[model samples]
Every structure is written in structure tokens, then in C-alpha cells.
Target chain A: MKRYTVTIGDITHVVDLQPLNDAEHYRVWVDGQVYDVALSEAPDHEPQVHPHPSTEAIPSASPAAARDRPADTATEPADLRAPMPGVILEVNVEPGAEVQRGDQVLVLEAMKMKNAIRSPRSGIVAEVLVRPGQSVNYDEPLLRYRQG
Target chain B: MNLLDTLLAGLLSLSWGQVVMMGIGGLLIYLAIAKEYEPVLLLPIGAGAILANLPLSPLVGDDGLLTILYNAGVGNEMFPLLIFVGIGAMTDFGPLLEQPHMLLMGAAGQFGIFGTLFLALLLGFDINEAASIGIIGAIDGPTSIYVSNQLAPHLLGPIAVVAYSYMSLVPIIQPPIMRALVSRRQRLIRMPYSQRPVSRRTRILFPIIVTAVVGLLVPMAIPLIGMLMLGNLMKEAGVVERLVGASSNEIANAVTLFLGLAIGATMRAEAFLRPQTLLILLLGIFAFGLDTAAGLVFARLLRWVVRGPLNPLIGAAGISAFPMAARVVQRVAQEEDFENFLLMHAMGANTAGQIASVVAGGVVLALFAAR
Candidate 1:
């Protein structure tokens, strides 16, 4: 459960969010009143790791929506992300591997077809976020590149 | 002395044709086991052929096990229709719903069926037999079996084999035709994924509406479409989870074995080793090529009029090989531009082909079955 403190026009409320079956659906409690919500589209670049809401969260925004800003803002270029939901069949690159744009980085099996995922840009790999056989949701980060 | 005479009698009666048929059966079994080419059906088919082709085989006479299964299922066309129920339950028409315009490609993908039908007639096959061969153009195994059993029972074995063999070869067969027809500039065209929110109510109503509309338009289509829609209705309703599970898994698997075996039994040496069998095999390739070309040309025509960023390669997916054809579209597109994701669009077309092929099967039967 992710807890947040909210102030809407000077009225404060305590919110508790609990994830349900999938990443999109959640059970949210606002001042002890509960409601189930489902997002129509999953957030494109939701950070795999979350910082606690008490420290860095804003005052009033729907916390989930807040995480879903423009995709280009904080995400560095060449940090490979899954374009669709699939299981990673193989990950060819490790940390610090030098790669060129359009080189095969990994193979992802989705819809029973093996999709060879290629590097979007030429860069040095900083870290690999996922390993072979890991099932990933659409747009989940696969690996990150070293920032210049 | 009696037991020895009985054992020697079996060897004495075996002919070259039976031996050749058994060898073919063994080859099919080998392909199914080693290569894993549509093994679920092929393995059963190979086994059935071997069982039926043995000299004075118990499985070949009127009261035989293989014949009983063939008469009960394939003879009446029950197995193929049952298989369609499972197919309907498994198919997700969401991508087609998201992009309704892709239905044109589905319709165009069936061009080879009619084209092949005419070719078969010129090659001296009777109208009904030609029509049966044409259904293989869609690469839809169940429909081919359904139509062939009804129209040309003699050709059922070869037609079913060709349909299944080509369906497994989808990845290998489709790429070259797709790459050839679509130039590099057209191949690189990117289609961004659009996830339209299809409502629960809409999903529930889709199957009912399709069954009614299609049933009325072509009454002959009622059986295939009705079963297909029934399965889809169960899936979308989500209330009949048990029924959906049974149809897609238990019932389908059981019937696939029966159907493949029955179709295989029809490949008795006398019926299968004909010169016309070779012609049917050649026409199978012709039909697939024409179907792919027709789809590509149709999509290119649509692009000119609609002025959308449509990739012609998605047209190849209109062949109704289900998700396989759709995946090939994605594979080929990524070959030219790795970022291009034509999967959703191709799936839309592929699913449309699923329905269109059924409708085409009905149309073909309506035109030629009685006459």
C-alpha cells in the first residue's frame, strides 16, 4: 500500500492506495472511503522503484497520474523499454556493453512470436533492469544507458 | 499350422500402394515428432494413416475404428465446426474492433480461393472438387475440411494436409511475398498503436450481432458462424467461464484428434496416390501467393484513397492464419524499420480474414454444393 497526504483547497485528507490484480487496477481509500479504480492506459514510464510519497509527493494530485508525466521529461535516451507486454527470451547485453543503434539487444517473445528488440540509439549500457525469462508489462524499462 | 498360415496371409496380401501409403504416414509422423510441424493434428493423422493402410487392416473395413470416427465426425462435418467453436473462444476481436477499416484486407485475402477455384476447373476438376481445393487458399484447416467433406469427400485428405502443412509454414512462406510486393519506402511506414476503449457492453453484443447479420446474409454460413460466435459470446460474456474452458481446451483437443485421424483415414492408397493429388498440392501454393498478392494490392489501393500511413506488408496478414500471420507482419516490418509495430493493425486484418474466410466458405458452398 502507498500512503499519501493530500490537501485540496485547504482541506487535508489521508489517501491509501493498494494495488490489485494488475498494475492498472487499484483500491484507493480517501479518508476511509474506499473505491476501486482502473486506469484505461498504463503509464508509459512508471519508475520500477518508487520513492515514498511522504517525502517527494505533491500536495493534491492523484499520485498515480502524477507519476505519468510526459515520457521525454526524465527518461534518458537509449534506455530500452518493452514496447509491448512479453517475456524476455534473452538479454544479450550486460552492464557497460557498448552498442550501436538498431543492434539486436535482446529477444522478447510476445503473442508466441520471438521479437528481436534492437537498441534505439548507440550508447553504453549503464544497467540491465530485467533478466531473461522475466515477464514485463508494456513500456517497462529493460535496461538503462550510461548518462553522458 | 493355422496360426502360421494367418500370419503369412497378411504379408501375402500387402501391395506396393499400401506400403507407399504407410511410408507417407511414417514420414508425416517423423515431421510431426522431429520438426514439430502442427504435431497435435499431424501426429494423429500419421497414426491414423498407418492404421488404415495396413493390409486387411481391422481399422479399414466398414466396422473399423478409423472408419467409424470418419463417418461420425468428418462425414457429417461435426469436427471442423466444433474446432471453430474453440477458435472463436480463443480469438480476441478487440484489435479488429479498434480499427474496423482493416476488414477490407480480410475480404481481399480470400481472392485466391475464387481464383484457384477457376484454375481448378480449367485443370479439369469438377466444380465441387475445384471449390473444395479453393478453400485451401485461406490456409484455414477447419474450413477446408468442412467444405471438402461436404463438396468433395475424395479430396478431403490432400486438402486437409495442404492446409495444415502451409499453416505451420506461415513464417517461412509469408515473408518473401510480403517483402517482394511492398517496397522499402512502404515497408518502413510506421503505425502507432491505438488502444481504443472497447466497452464491456460492446464486447458482449459483438458476437450476437455478427451471428444474426452473417446468418441472414448467407444462410449456409449459419453453422460455422453460429458456432464461432457462440464460443466468442461465451468468452466475452465471461459468465460461462466453464463452457469457454471446455470448448477451447477439452472439447477442441479431443475433436482435433478425431478430425485429423478421420481426415487421415480418407487418405487410403486408392484415393491418395492419384495424379490429381499432385495438382492439388501445386494449386495450394498458387492460392496462397494469389491471396497474399491480392491483399497487398488491396491495401495499397486503400492507402492511395485514405492517405493514411499504411504499410502494405500488413496486407499479407489478411490470410486468416490468425496470430501467426499478424506476427509475420510485425517481423517483416521490423526487418526494415525496427521501430515499426504493425502487429495491432495486422491482427485487425487477420481476425477480419478469420470471419471473411468463413463467409467465403459459405459463399463457395452455396454456389456449388448442390449442383
Candidate 2:
């Protein structure tokens, strides 16, 4: 479940969306009221709304989201963690560096293959805990963040 | 005079074929040592090939060591079955268990095996040999060995080398096809790892149930799946650390040497340098690319309908290369949008491919065993 503060005009609503079996359907709570929603690709003129009111998907209350925002830009904590065990090949982000979701923050070498760990959200890096050539374990936190 | 003549015979009896094969052996060793490609198996295989091709080498006759290992393990398919246990103990099905629907993509990955078989038949290979060559697309070395040795023992040398080499080349082979087939938007799609934890009881029962079910469905696969699940059962059972350690580490290491050497011994110039070997090599890469393509197309079809969290990149990993295929998929996705993490989802598809490939191998045997 993800919580989003959605604003339409002057009225702001706190909405929580929970996915059902598929990405299209969701059980959502809007300002404490619950509704079941199913999302589908809409024709050009139609709005992208589903089980919840078409008001929210992006986690932040700010208007940084776009009209073309993807449905999966689900809010997550800004801090990034190593997805698997590996050695840090490089660090691309430092504390106070502004980053977008999907920006490569570091490269990790695992099983002789290199993987880049990307920022989970558009946030300011608070701290980087690892350095190049340092071996790390699975789920070990690699970075801390302040939300953008 | 006879004793002096016999001593000089070894120096005089060199053939162009033996010389060429020895060079090939050197290449294999260079690949293993310098390129770091599946060294544990390839190094022994390279050495065995060199030993087998030595002028009047004693290690390759009826009473010879290499021949003995070949007869004992590879000829009868003992080594592959043993290796399957090791592979099972090493694989963790947690991600696959977390998401079960990925099995469909796994099934889709086998289309290449059949596709290659048809192409090989058209190119004049007998049906059984074609099937053995096709199994290289399965991308699991031991299964490739088991199926090929069972179906076309003569083709085992080329098939083994091709399978291992292509398995190593997966990252390169898959990315272009994946990029071509899946759109950028689809590649950038995110699939967070599922949080649902599989229960300990479910983990333990998983191997047992899979063995019984897969065994009954394709009884010929019983040998492959049974041993695989047995090793999996040991790992999940939690009471068999010693057993799991031996199966996954020491025993696997030992059998890999015997298997590699035995397989290499079969690569006598007379066997390994056929025109058909070239065809098998071509068909192996073709089949691998086809499997990746088929998987991507299948997943795209799924996304068209269900429409959520279905990253087509995960489809590329729907092959038996295990975590390697999955890792490649993850890397590709991250290349497009660093924030999108598809590793867990790709792993689900990869592990599914592993099981499906084994089952497909059994199906092949069941169909052609009578021939």
C-alpha cells in the first residue's frame, strides 16, 4: 500500500492505494473512505483512473509529478539498499547530491557481473555508506536519503 | 631391434587431426584460464582432450583412465544426474515461489529447442541427433549432457562445449534481442520484489510435491527432476547441512572433473571435427536467441492483457541459465532507468525456466526414447 496526498484545486485528499492481484486493480482508501478500483489503458481523451479516484499515484504532496507520470512511480523511501550481495565497483552519488528516480548511484559487481544501483526516488543523498571495492551483503543499506 | 622400433613409434605416429585437436584443447584451456569461462569444467575438459589426442595415448583405450571414466559416468548418464542434485541444492526457488505465474514464460522459453530441432532436421540431421543439438538451448549444462548423451552420444562433445560457451555468452546474446523486442517504456517498468515470505513448511514440501507431480507428468524426467528435487529437499529440510554442503560443494566439484574429462575424451578428432559440429554450433546460438525472443514476445502478450508490473525485460530471463539470465535482465532494465529494479521478478522467471527446461528434456526423451 502507498499513501499519497493528492490536490485538485484547493481541496486536498489523503489517498492510500493497495494493488489487487494485478497492477490494474486496487483497493484504495481516500480520506479514510475505501473503494475498489480497476485501471485500464484509456483512449487519448479519457483520464487514467481506476479503483481509486483518478487523483493520486505519486507519493509526494508536491506537484513535481507530470501529467504523463507512470503508474509505478509508487512512493518509496529515498534510501537505497543493495539488492544482492556484491562489491561496490563505484559510487556515483554523494550526500547532498540531488537525484532523480532511476539515476545510477553506484555500480556493484556480483558473480563477475556488474550491476548499477539506482536511486529509488527523487531525493537528496544524506549519506553514502559504501565505497569502491567494498564487499557488501544482501539488503545491506548502501545509502541514506532526504526526500526531494 | 623390435624394442627400439616401438620406442620411436610414438614420435613418428602424428596425424594432422591429432595436431589440430591438441590446438583446440589449448584454445579451450586458454578460454578457461584467460577468459574465465566455466573454468572448473572447461579446464579439466581441455586437459582431457589434450591427453586423449596424444600419439598412441594410453589414457584413451579400453583399459584407459579417461575411457574408464567415460564408460562409468558419462556413457550411462550417471554424472549428469549426480550434478543435477548439486544444482538443486545451490538453487533457491524463493523468488519463483513468491510469484508462480512466471511459469508460463518458462514454458515459452522451450519454443527454441523445438524450433532448432525443426531447422536441424531440414539441414539433414537425423531426428535424434537434432533433438540432442536442440537441447543445448536448454542452457543447463548437465541436462544438456544427459539428454544429448542419451539421445546422440556421438554429438555430446560439440553439444557440451556449445552449451557451456553459450551459457557464458548469455549476457551478450540476450541484451540486443531484449532491447529489440521490448520497448523502452517496457524496459523501464518496475517490479519490486514481492514481500510475501514462503512458509518453511511450504519450502520443504515444495521439492517433494514438485518431484511427484513432475515425475508423474513426464515420467522420463523423473531421473532429472527427482535428483534435482532431492537436493532441493535437502537444502530446504534445514537438518541436512552436511549433506547439502557435500552435495553442493565437494561432490559436485569431484563429479564435474570426471564429467568434464569424460566428455573431453569423446572429442577425438574423428568425432569433434565433423561438418555437423559446425551446424550444431550455429544452431545452438540460434536456439538461444530464439528462446530469448520467444520469452519476450510471450511476456509482451501477457502485459497486453493483465497490464501491471509486467516488465517484458523479465521475459528474456526465462531460460535455464539460472541467476545469470536473471542478472542480465536486471542489468538491462537498470541500464534504461536506474531506479527500476527487476531482479527479483527476473529471478522468478529464470528459476521457472530451470524447472521447465528439465521437464522439456523429459518430454523430449519420452517422445523419442522408443526410436
Candidate 3:
């Protein structure tokens, strides 16, 4: 049993969870609140969780295969980030746009504040990953940049 | 009396005090528009002051629109709570969760709130009134309202104005204090950007857990924390997109308009012209300065233990201006090292400051109530 102190919305709950045979499945008791948790790896660190249906079976990964997978897959380089989690108000720099450090590359509107995301270093823009109005995470690469 | 004679008489009877207050009000308006200092509050406040100081404006009268708004929102404390809902919907606590220890910085930054509270008491302001005045140091509007409404409702207008005014001045007041507290080498420290993927379960559970813990600790904070968490839970739940959108946008906008206008209208010359108001304004600035100093000092202490680059300037982000304080930290960090990017770290501390300010506000109320 792994004891996890989970704090949600200002209330801290000491949770004890019995790990299942499958890496993704666990029986969690959070301060007496029971939750059956299933973990899934999302693309690009997007926090998307679909509650598992009661009838769905937990998929098990063998110990040998589990050992081969590397940890820390979610870390992204600093140059590629959303600046703030918000709707992309505009994307000014396109693929192959030669940009210098501090060049305004995109406008993000979060909590009614218009923030300009600038290029981290002088580079040739490799790809623009998001479009206008696309909601992005804090670490998701907004664009790729190659050395100019 | 003839119409011309009555009009001239009314113009001539305008009090010198009212004229001076009007001019002071106009200066505030000018600062808001021209200098762009806290435009959201100052613009409306300046307008309200001007209108009220006019020879015979109906706006301050019993039947006036301003009076009606004041009664509907500010006097009753509904608008600030509603605004908290919007603030809740808009806030992203992921940064704070990623760096749980940053909460210490937030706590340290709130020294201004209590520090100023003590100072106000020293100046002979009564316990309850001093508590209300000291909350302006929190640099948070809703918390200021929540505390002042309970302790000293009469001082609400000055406290709110000072709270917001000093919040905007964070960029100006904080940087120098930060510099003074930390050396050039400290500011140049580059924090590595590390992104830890937070689970949706954790996100959804955060507001609930925080509300429960804080509410249990300070029952008076139940309303404020409950409403804040309610909004956060709605946003994190992902199923309540429509409710989140409405709360964050429409409800927030409506509340801000009402809250801003009503808060402004409370600055009647008679109420706001006193020396106490001036002292409140001065103490408000001092409180913010002290808060920034405390955060920087705490960050320097943490640097001794924590590995990796911990930019001390990011500690200044502990003030509760949300992203603005974070951006200012980012800007200052960029000035020090062209390659250094501290935005994410600054944001983490800034988000922690948001929660810390609420907790600090609650703690203050709890302390005063206990007394």
C-alpha cells in the first residue's frame, strides 16, 4: 500500500492505494473517498483524462516491457512553450520566419490579459504547432525553431 | 429666485474643500488614463469622485444610480464574491501544484499584510480598523473586501483603492526592493524549466482539498475559499465547460463593472478627505514594498538549500497580481541574462501567491476574530 497525501481544492486527504497487477490500475481511498484510478500517457503532456467505464478491463503491461520504457518523457525544451495556458489569440510567425531574440511570435490571451510570446533565441522557425484559438498547455511546443 | 441668480449662487457656494477634493480626484483620473496606473479601478474611482464633488450631482443622492449600485454591491458585499467566481474560473493552479514548495514564497510575500496591520495599530488605528487597513497590503481585491467588510466596513473604499493601486505599482515598487534585498549575482541565477505533468485527478481534487483544509482551519474563510474552489472545481472538472465559460466571462465582467463603479462611488469628499485616508495610501505602498522584500529574502534563504538556479527575482512574483507580477519577473530576468527564461518559475510562484494571499487573508481574519 502506497500512502499518498493528496490535496484537492484546499483539502488535504491522506490516500492509501493498493496497486493492481496492471501498472495503470489502482484502488485508491482518499480520506475514505474511494476512487479507482487508471493512468494513461497523453500526447504532449495534455492533461486529458477520460473516466474509465465500470466494465472496461485494465490493460496489463508485462514486467519486462515496463522496465524497458524510459521515464521523464514529458520534459520539453525551453524554446517551445505556450508562455501561459490560454487560447492562442494570434500566430504572427510562420514556418521559416527568421526571428531574433525578443521578437513577438504569438499573442496569448489568458484571464483577459494579452501576453506576447516571443522567440527565445535567434532562429529560423521550423514549424508552427498551433493555430489561432487553439488552447495550449504550459509546456506544449507552440513552434519549433532551428538555428538560423 | 430667478434661474440665472440661482445658478450663480450655487456655483459661488461650492466649498473650497470640495474643489480641492475634485482636483485630487481629477489627478487620479489623469493617472489612470495618461499614466495607465490601475486603470480598471482608478478610472471609475476618478469619475465617481468628480461626479460626487460637483456642485449638486444627483449621482450621490439617495435616488442616484451610483447610490443604487453602491447599495446593490459594495455595501452588501455581493459583487466581490461574484468576482471571485470569475477569478476562480480564470486561475490555473497547475504551476503551484508542480512546485508545492513555492507556497512558502507566497507565504513570505504576505508579510506585508500583517506587517502593515501592526504598523497601522501602532499609529493608533483601532484593532478592527487597522486590520481592515492592513489587508490592503495583500494586493488582492476580493481578500481586501472580505476582510474589511467584516472588520471595518466604513474604510472599504480607501482599502480597496489602495489595494488595487498598489497592486498595479508592483512593477515599480517591487523591482527596487528586490534589487536592494538581493545582490546582482542572485538576480542572474537562471532557473531551469522543468515541467511535471499533473494528473487530471490531482487538478480536480486540488480546489476541493484546499477549500476543506482552509475552511476547517478558519471558518470565517469558508465563504471566500468555498466560492474560489467552486470555480476552480468547475474549470478542472472538464465536464462543466459551459458553466466555466459563463462564470469566467459574463459573470466576472458584470461583477467587475458593478464592483468597480460601486467602489469608486464610495470616495465621497467627506469620507475620503481625512488624514487617515492619506495614511492608508502611504501604508499601502509600504506594505507592498515590505512584501516584495520579504519574498526576496525568503528566496535567498531557499537558494542555500535548493539545487539548481533559483532566480531571486522570481520571488518578487509572490505578489498577487497574477500574470502581471509573473511577467515583470520574466522581464527583469531577461534583462540579467539574455538566455535565461524564468517565466514558468515566476508563474509558479505567482500562482502560489494567489492561493497564499487568500490564506493570509483568512489567517488575518481568524487572528482578529480570536482577539
- For residues A1-148, write the lDDT of model 3, one tens digit per residue: 6543222221223445677898667777755678776655444543322121111121323434322332112111225576456789999998978987668899877544566776655668888999998998755678887632
In model 3, how large is the Cα lDDT of residue B117?
90
Candidate 1: where are CA atoms >4 Å away?
Answer: A1-82, A85-99, A103-109, A124-147, B1-5
lDDT of 3 by residue, B1-371 (tens): 68887778658768876787688778878989998987876777777777777777788799998899888877767787787887888888887888888887888878888899999999989998888888887788888987897788878878888887777777787777766777765665555455688999999999999999988887777777788889999999999999999999998877777777677777766777899999999889988888888888888888778765577887888878787788878767656544355677777798788878888888888888666
> How do the residues B119-166 of candidate 2 rate in per-residue lDDT, one tens digit apiece?
999999999998998888788899899999989988999999899888
DockQ per candidate, 2 decimals: 0.06, 0.12, 0.03
The Cα local distance difference test for each model comes to: 0.82, 0.82, 0.75
What is the alpha-carbon lDDT for the whole of candidate 2?
0.82
Candidate 1, residues A36-134, lDDT tens digits: the string is 876555446554322222112234255576445421222235467776667999999989999886778988887667888888667799999998999
Best by DockQ: 2
Error of 3 at B202 (Å): 1.6
List candidate 3 stretches off by more than 4 Å.
A1-148, B2-13, B369-371
True contacts kept of each: 0.10, 0.17, 0.02
**lDDT by residue for model 1 (B115-158), tens:** 99999999999999999999999779999998988899889999
Worst 10 residues of 1 chain B by lDDT: B188-197
**C-alpha lDDT (0 to 100) for residue B136 of candidate 1:** 96
